[model samples]
Target: MRPVSVRYDNSSVRVCMKKKAMCKIGLAVMLLLTPMMGWSAKRLNIVIIVGDDWGGPYASAYTGIYGRNLPSNVVKTPNVDRIAQNGVLFKNAYVNAPSCTPSRSSIFTGRYFFNTGGGAVLGGTWDFTIPSFPLLLLDAGYHIGLTSKGWSPGTPRNAPFGGTAHYYQYFGTSVSSFSKSVTKWTAKGMPFEKAKQTMLDQVRGNFEAFLADRKPDQPFFYWFGPTNTHRTWVKGSGKALWGIEPDSLKDQLPVYLPNNPEVREDMADYLGEIQALDAYIGVLLKKLEEIGELDNTIIVATGDNGPGGFPRGKWNLYDFGVATPLVVWYPHSTGGRVVTDFTTLMDLAPTFLEVAGVAIPPKTDGRSLLNILTSPLSGQVDPQRTFAITGEERHNAKARDDSLPYPARALRTARYLYIRNFAPDRWPMGCPYVAAHVPYVFHDIGEPSPTYDWIITNRSIPSAADYFTWAFAKRPAEELYDAHKDPGQINNVADDPMYADIKKSLAEKLLAELKKAGDPRVIGDGGTFDRPPYTDLKTVACQDTIPLNWAPGSHH
Candidate 1:
């Protein structure tokens, strides 16, 4: 299929309204022409399948094939592949933030991370003032339910007076209880394949329960967050339990990581988790088809952020870190296409609202993708989607002086990526040493993993020191990468005089957008973000070296 050419101008609003008006007029004309048509507007069902820490390339549909010999193939996502084949696949989708909490917050609220205040930082409280699409859909009479993870890792501090309980009530029911009950069904004595199937069945069972309990005539919005790909996986289970060979995955390792047996083993395990998630998705799709709601439902499959536990991937602003896989299957609308326009996950919130015929809130920073989704053509349906911006604040504040966030923002265009680090002196990852009386330790990586341990142990070795630097070293204030020439983003071209013009242009564009969005960093109130009280007090440690007067306990 040829790539579709689209031109996006300032008249997007007018275009959208005109299209909507025409649709309404067409409906009215049809009714006037024939009363026997019996066409009634029906609410659409929404199902968002979000994977935790899953990268774009892991899905076979995105990478073009599913096999052990294929490069970058550690897992086969046939179910996810089906969604992309049957719907519109976004080739260039990025998260607002690389970390889970902040990224998910932006996705739910349709706002930028910095605009979310305390919610911008990891494990920080969510400001309830910002609207969530689910709540809006619920208010609009759509049955809403969430399984596994939701707006999580941090507490919703302002969720009415009842706190977390009230928050769950807003979603109708929390499926965590059901999830726990199903976990018991995975008996220890069961065979590996049977046990894995049982676990996947549990997830599907939760979704079935939600469907069974919903009002028959009312449409529904379901948020399905699977935790399969998260860290602390069953080590070597891919080989011992899942029958996946580590050798088969060696060639599939990410370019940023060393192509060794240990890394390949880790990748295989991760792929195992991804395959499990994909199987569960197949179950959900089958259920939707059986219930006769498949065609009426809007199914969206995506990831919160990039791969976790890998170097310069998760928790970093590199392309692999922030890029996500987005597949949208809106029945009776658009299908069998691919969109190359730059897209942010935040757009999903506005897209959902627009599709539901609900007004998008004024504070939303993301534009609706409804125009692109409904359009028959693919590729660049929205010409204005030429860039994607992502930022990062504090993430995993466990290392010494971790309260001092490594603040950074980045702008990604079709050919280049520009980043501006607010605090260049601090380590991009956590400080090498902890506050406690212990040897060199790094805690900012979020979870404990063999990949991280290998990097830390070999930091002093001449052969592996560069990898360590790439993973945890302090970065310069400005960084630029030629995306076309270096998709891996291994080279820093910011200091190259030849590319100064491009760098300056991207930097200015990013700053202008940030300022327009009322970002705290550009508006001169950025200090407030750094001063927000940490949700987990234990992660706080004194940062005496910071130039700012902010201290751990003193911020309060």
Candidate 2:
């Protein structure tokens, strides 16, 4: 029994004189480090929880062709289906640019949202020489932070995650304005479920102030980016705050959106802001099961794009505008499983640097799913994880005209989706009127509710003229689809003729994945994303009015 040496640090250094010799050196360092602790592998702790116009094949956990024609889920999200019943749910995820600052700058630089030059589109310009897996897990020491919208309406210039000094926002982003700050904190009298429980206690007081300001055992990486499911809510707050019955979502619409009752009460108020972000993700999964760090944390819910005032969902790449809503969760892996892997939130910055062992940055175009999340072989586990490749140069750099960037690119596979409209003579949505950034007329379809006033007052009525030419037409620079027979991509069988050899073999496999990712829009007369720091509309500045003070009565 020669195991009782004496020394215990607890929270600092303690040479161990007494206190029962520091409790027999914490019982001889737990019997000599409990069997090499899996070769010292406790780095995990990442979190993510993204969400912002969070899309998915409208969730029934997307079975068969990923929620084929909206499989189910009117909106329950038991804590986002209990983090997909404790992890791994991505029925084919995506988002290599659907909008929100180049789909969160391709999940903060796993790369390929057009290689994120000017953070590649939609108010772009955060390209601080790209390389930010949360600032490389805050330079490998970890303990990163971020609350509302992280790689945001870009132009931040630097600090991919350590900028606003590791940003927490005591409680500002006002829980991303859920129901307009709970209808202005229930009009100041404050009791509408106590002003929505103070915006879900501002998402559990900003992740308990970034886990009580990390330091001990460090290793964090939060991000929690909420956005109230991105868009102007409150038009009958999905049956007034989540009863969610716009006629029970009119048989789960989606035939190229244009169903009735004001677009089924705006798709039941965007599924009541995703059931108020699943009750703020069950208050961050009961604060990581009461701070024990819920099995050393990995979590990851997801979504950075899709469904913002519908119609080919947010800034279109289609597949419901790069549908996302992955899942993940960790610790022993494989629970309630389902992976079908062809993911891309730029494979989550090399899957958070291969589960924090970190180093995967040789111009990463995303790959480390860490053996398809510790594989248990769920359908399509990895077989080179098939294809994903989405793109869109500009979302609203004034849609077009002197700013022009509706350039496009896409490739999704597992039975094709292929598109390539690199400016099919422009106007794919923008300039028939409002050409300086959204104010009516095809502003890249979103944010004008009642499905943009029932397709702009039924554009000449003929059965709403094919729902206003499938939400503002302008195409034909190739577009194939057999995505297992057009999974609501609204049929664009390219130039038919027996799929012309499947559209010249998926346009040479999307131009060899944009010339193997040099992608200055196909690297030739691609016009380097067509001019000036990709049409540098003055590095998209101007943002001031931020006085929410966490809104509930907003401190008078």
Candidate 3:
């Protein structure tokens, strides 16, 4: 018919032109859509804040044993509270390991520490090949950047023990104080005022510069790691920030120690460090809002490991050492939902990708909490998602009296915790003479905190035995606790007949999980590496014989 009308009117010519123009526009739209693939939807921005060696329930709002003593206003963390108020707070969050490098490895790769080459802590020449959260985001056309530690010091760049660093090249790196301190143990203990000022100045400048320089066109993934909550007693620092004197903090002790006044004072300094860390977080949040990026950004705050100490925590399998605070705030998820399900730091990598709407690699051991964030009706994680496992190989050996370390693993569920100690005869805390760890265990023990003095002096008293055992006892093959009744894990129930079923069930599960992840201790019938090697071995070793690796780098 149109051919017959070849003698077209001017109107027909106009119609033809309009149709051709529409076709061109459609083609262009399709071409543009092609690059979008499945991520055409709005992308989510991510920011992670990691507190060094912070513990769970430290914030004032929680009623757990850890926070029971904090006055509503004792630790003024309005900003941290704001995050919890706006988003969900995970009540049972944990690290795969209680030590730094291993916990961080879990956070980065979304795999169990046993699965990672770093068997326990930063040593073990940890493998970095496992994919990281930031790396996943970067691959998805998002701008990835980190201001603090990404993949760290003890991790090597090879085989099962070594892996890849996703953020090394993709993200622009800022000199991080925490990472630097980890690299080389300098400035054992900076004066409180100087340390606080130094940290504030460096962190502020770094954050401001980061926000100022980020690429606007792409969504960003930024991590700000602060070195405050980790140790090396800085006096008077807590008073200036939290308005709490060292004595007041000592009075609010989480653990009672009859012997060490200096150790108690040191606890005050540690609490002060937490306060300072909280303050910097406030600063970072304000800066983000100033840059007009706070709302759309998803913020995650947690610790790299548990509190750095001896006995009941730190290199051991106890709530005080491995359990940590995990607060997440997303535009869609911030509604104060409290999740009691067990979750590990390893889940962080997958969670980051899922938030950004990226494909999660099958190799990842973590599952996204995004579904829980978006669906409040879904109240709990799956029942199978009931356990958390952690281990230890070596920390700063130079910092311990025992230069050669022990290997250990733990399995924790809602009510029960089972720890399998491979070398019960080995010292749990480093030896008193190994230079790297000597000062922290010996000189520093009586100087800053009572807990240390109490631990060392009362190892012989039967009533105080568990308390001391929590800190330094060599153990049997296994230790078990009913976390519901004993969150402190003061008693060993593994040998008790009453917990026979629990012990058997927990031990079995632990074995399965560990075997699945290929842990050497499990596979080799309980053998351990002598000590993980470090890049700065000689330098770190020279510092203390029991050298400390707590100082943040000068630039960070």
Candidate 4:
């Protein structure tokens, strides 16, 4: 084509004018695209789903061995499995503490359980004031909404952030508050309908509503912590409700029972709850997809602690207790990848902030795994990030044999697990074993069932003793296990002659991490817990094991 030669007058001027026009166009394009890129990097919609008192075996990624090898008996966590399948599934993940409130507090604050100073479960209003993870996200321009249990049974009103997440819904049917709710089912039966209603009516429904209510702000962070599969078992009519049968699930037999029928049934009911929770999670996932946020959203699904009330499950420093499943899904990036790194609950807050392109506060101890998710094949992780440490303060005090307090700390890695018991002689379960007429916590153990009866009747037998004796048994300053060889963590190989070198190395590593994490209970120094008359093991005397037929809300 013949072009018109119109720029012959003032040739230098024309050249300069052309260069200026190109510069202006470049600047305009940059101005427009820069914001879009920044928005993409900064805009993150996060959903964290924490299962109540669950462990790694419940999730399908880790061999799906909750109680047995039966596939039909396993927990059907399709939504949770979806997270693992879509993102990086951390095969070796752990909670900083094995107990409820303490683990959650550590997770939120990115602090060790010892520093939190509240113990395993919250006792009262004074116990609530710990730092929160959501508050930090809120400060970083996130619209935070919590469905069901967020930061705790009690609020962290006194911590630096000082305020709680916008708790849109409280899940489960329990409404006695976090403290009394523990005692609500002191009798033999399941929890009151109020407890179940709270979950069905409020927690699940509220989560759906919360999803529907989002306005697409700068970014949104939602905590969808559920109360599914916690306790007070419910069995649906003929078919099992939650894709599990308690008796059919695998039972680890916590140092107490040797594969008994009664215990199997109880375990089945627990699995039912897990299955039911899984279905609800599926609902949430469907909602996310329906709202067109599924592809861009980051979904983290895991458990708060281990199984409740079993030996070395919920309250102890064993892998069976502190080890949990961590499934992170970033549908837009790496999907269907499995990561074998050992991660911690404390890592959550920092990771959330890091993914959103926000500055991580110096006070936090957790390191972000965003890079790992974004570049799964590169293995991008801090070389220095090694181990996760967890601590415990108390369990159901009213449910112990000797009435002694249990205090412990632990460190875990891909290969090893180390436990340091501060109160070595104390019972992991509460000492006195309260025998109140009302539904007492430990009275459930005193029931006439075969396993319970065997445990109470044969306290003299080492294997048949209650959890108090099992927990109160002799312990070393350090106990280590090679998790690769011993996933169940039954054999105590800390003193084995063959693994002496490994033990020494793990001990040194544990001390270094504890010190780095600001744990005061290093070596024998005993952290700052010098409060006089710390919880006691004073026993309450009673006549016989409480009856199992006690009515709801009645004396045991």
Highest-scoring model, TM-score = 1
TM-score of each: 0.83, 0.34, 0.76, 0.75
Candidate 4, residues 311-393: lDDT per residue as tens digits? 56666677667878787887677677766566788888778766665445445677777777887552324455567777765
Q: Of the pair 1 and 2, which is ahead by TM-score? A: 1
Worst 10 residues of 4 by lDDT: 1-10
lDDT of each: 0.72, 0.72, 0.60, 0.57
Measured over all alpha carbons after superposition, the RMSD of each candidate to the real structure, in angstroms, is 8.8, 22.1, 12.0, 12.1
Local accuracy of candidate 3 as per-residue lDDT tens digits, 528-547: 45533422233222222222
Better of 2 and 4 by lDDT: 2
> Of 2 and 4, which scores higher on TM-score?
4
Task: Report residue 145 deviation for candidate 1 (angstroms).
Answer: 0.4
Between prediction 1 and prediction 3, the one with superior lDDT is: 1
* Preferred candidate (TM-score higher): 1 or 4: 1
Where does candidate 2 have its weakest 10-residue lDDT segment? Answer: 4-13
